[model samples]
Target: MRRTVARRLAAVLATTAVVAAGVAMSITNASAATGGVTGYATQNGGTTGGAGGATVRATTGTQINQALCNRASDSTPIIIQVEGTINHGNTTDVSGSSCDVGSTLIDLKGVSNVTIVGVGAGATFDQIGIHIRESSNIILQNLTVKNVKKSGSPLSNGGDAIGMESGVRNVWADHLTLEASGGEAEGYDGLFDMKNDTKYVTLSYSIMRNSERGGLVGSSETDLTNSFITYHHNLYQNLNSRVPLLRGGTAHVYNNHYVGIVESGINSRAGAKAKVDNNYFEDSKDVLGTFYTDERGTWQTSGNILDNVTWSAQGSENYPAGPSMPSTTTVSIPYSYALDNASCVPSIVAKTAGANKGNQVSDGSCNAQSPSQSPSNPTTSPTTGPTDPGTSPTNPPGGTNLSLGAGADGSSKADGTSYGNVIDGNMSTYWSPSGTTGTVSVKWSSAKTIDTVNIREASGTAGNIDNWQLVNHATGAVLASGTGAGVISFTAVSTTKVSFVITSASGTPRVAEFEVYA
Candidate 1:
């Protein structure tokens, strides 16, 4: 960032499990909160931000636009709770009717179930940048957004530290720490850009450094319907290229950890279709393909790990993917993700990429784990809550239920209702949805490594499942959300299916038992 000293909010460790050489790691309690909402913002109908809403406590940027102009509409569903530093004179520009905040940094226009998370002693937006337009379900947890400037003196957003354009959709930006301070002749730009038709997005465990642009999905070259995007376990350092420069559609870079990068990375051009997996590029240089122009883009690499990488020579606008990184193309991916072995991804993204560390993760057989929970900070104290998450569970904690025999389905049900009656252990046999909202799932045939879940509601229909969204349907990872539901934890993940939609319901909603654990 521009350095003015204001970055402290990471401390959590009380052991959840650890083994090392033999690999057993599963840790996740460092004041919990983040371990859900993974890649691709968990597909279209996922990204349950601002859970059930109503939970304000801003600390500037005009109380986060007066908490979205005191929401009640504009897709009501709040969750401000920021604390400390939000420059440009504490962010102004208020107006109301459920807001449309402006003045650069922290814009988020046309709101929709918001969530600007980042609590106590943390939440820096210095030099400002956030500017999502025509918004949709959004969630920007544990922030740090840095330096900014498009050409000097506090002129934000256009400088891109988190710019999403017109048709933005589901966005889940976890543990951020975006930076800038040089490039474009030191005026900064693209730290997370997405253009026109931006769709399902997910930039997990973030940490993009030193600036020089490290963002772009579709902002030109036919602006191709900004497609389904997903970049997991991030940690792009020293930047100089669009660690994200895809131009057309479809992207899913997994387990990231690129370093130094310097002139190019990701660059997929016009018809973009990247699928690079199990990443861990080091000492980068032309981190991926298509640079400059000529319009060309397509990738499908696998199990990548280019240590001390550096490959350049091939002009006419340059085109490097690596010393022998072939694959050219072959990308399908509907959903269902799990891959964490590009040689332990640089020690699990340096103890969990960005934000305050602690939200560590891996458990896909590379060890280390920790997720969900987001308030009352401090495995050392800095205050951050949300992982003891909207509360409901009494002893009904973890302890096996893995959806009992596992194998159910949903999106529509009712009549005699049956998605295997909520996984069978009968809480009076339930599962309803034919009206009043939908989605109910559970499946398994391999892949399972959960992290608490328990819906249980029957007898007089305790609360009528009003507001939910805990996904993982293979790889749409969203893990947690709130509003009536006993026990709902999050962090460890390895899925095979696990939906539980329900969006909103105050009546006519029954789900006798949907238990799950790990």
Candidate 2:
């Protein structure tokens, strides 16, 4: 069952709906929150993290674990108020009959009914990761996790600022700041990641910035069990890709502001489905797509403002939803939410999305108020991590230059050029995208067994192709994914056509040869 108060009617619903249900959060000195949990996290039996439980205080990471350890049982409810900075230096493992404590992180392992909220001036987790494994009914709010190193002088959480795996459930994280200075090359992974059957989670009123991979759901194409997550009223800035690379499952993404997205965003691949509604996107490229691979995902877009967003020419592998983006599928949303007018998302989110901003939230009517109002409406989406484009592949398999005399096709051709230039057996001739990047392919009258492709750049434009995917166009299967174009080989498959998709490029790419071999 599915319904849409989004995409199809974003403008109409804004004026029609009254005060939204569950739109509030308050942290007066952060002693504890009096706010209500909204979004999908309220479903699946509800997530009341440490509500009605004994309150405890923790000034360091070890103390936080101690509070968890000292609980009567793993299921005993507890609220731990955190203050000051928590780093690897101040945190140590503590053992208890009811605890699974560890040093590298604030580990919530095999536990349930917990809330860790920041208080006083605020709480910061510096170079430390919050690890949630096999837990249920958890809430994390009013915190900042910054610059966690995966491999350096200090290490924690393998570069993910907050990672949940191993059958976790029912979490609501709000009013937080998760950031890193760089990409994986600088030892930072995802800002938030969920996998291995984690479900029914919500991330609202937060900010994530200055990182490459935003996050991911379901580690691979086969890990499809994770589902029912929401993200709303958040700000994602200066991120490269994976505004969540969701492999499978359903996600609701709305009322967020995204800026400076370099590579891609909201990559819903591997049959995943998302309800992308009422979000503002600016200065980005491929903001919505089923990119890099042929295992396409689906999104239903409504009232989304794509301001100055650049979309590459489409291909079998590089699929973008914008520049005439429409709903590919309808997503069923179980919770009722009040969507603010998309035009006001940027300002509404800026004042209310992160910690220490008085925990203000939307009234679902585009108004911002303190927790003195009711709780906030439920959330929108969880963006995933990206595919690891491997190293330069081996040489093209030994065979005749099958591309010669083949029918040449592409998404678009630049002025004074033709797609047939790529296969004309002349090194001087070339083809380029009508825009900065696009697709070029070779087709046959019938299927051919081929396993290798070599992309040769036209003279003087050698390094423009930064990331690419070789695909079986007939089946939409990614044969190989890698960085830079040379000779890429994969297992042979019989297909009538193959495409070379340039996902990102430093400049206009010129291909003199798109040679294939069998």
Give the least accurate 10-residue stretch of model 2, judged by summed lDDT: 25-34
Clashes of each: 21, 21
lDDT of each: 0.73, 0.77
Q: Which 10-residue span in candidate 1 carries the lowest summed lDDT?
A: 8-17
* Candidate 2 lDDT over residue span 1-518, tens digit each: 11221222333223212212222422111111124566777566566677556788899999998999998999897888888999988999999977898898889999997888887898999999898999998889889998888877488988889999999998889899998877777878899999999998999999888787788998898999999999998888778888878989999999888876778889999999999988888767899989988999999989888777899889988999879789999987654455677777777787688877777777655667665311121221111111232222345457698899789897677786779988987767788876434678999998889987888877666666655657678866667755666888788899999988664454467787888888
Q: Can you tell me which runs of candidate 2 are displaced by over 4 Å? A: 1-34, 373-518
Highest TM-score among the candidates is held by which one? 2
Residue 324 local lDDT, model 1: 73
TM-score of each predicted structure versus truth: 0.34, 0.66
Tens digit of lDDT per residue, candidate 1, span 1-518? 12111121110010101211222223321221235565566555566566656778888888888788877788887778787888888777888897878756678788886878887677888888888889898888888888888888878877887888888898888778898766777677788989899898888778887777789888789888898899987887777788899988989998787766767889999878899987878766778999898888889998787877788887887889778779799988754445677766666666677776655655555555675343222111111111221333468774678888889887677687688988888666777776434678888999988887888766666665545667787656556755666778888888888887764453456776788889
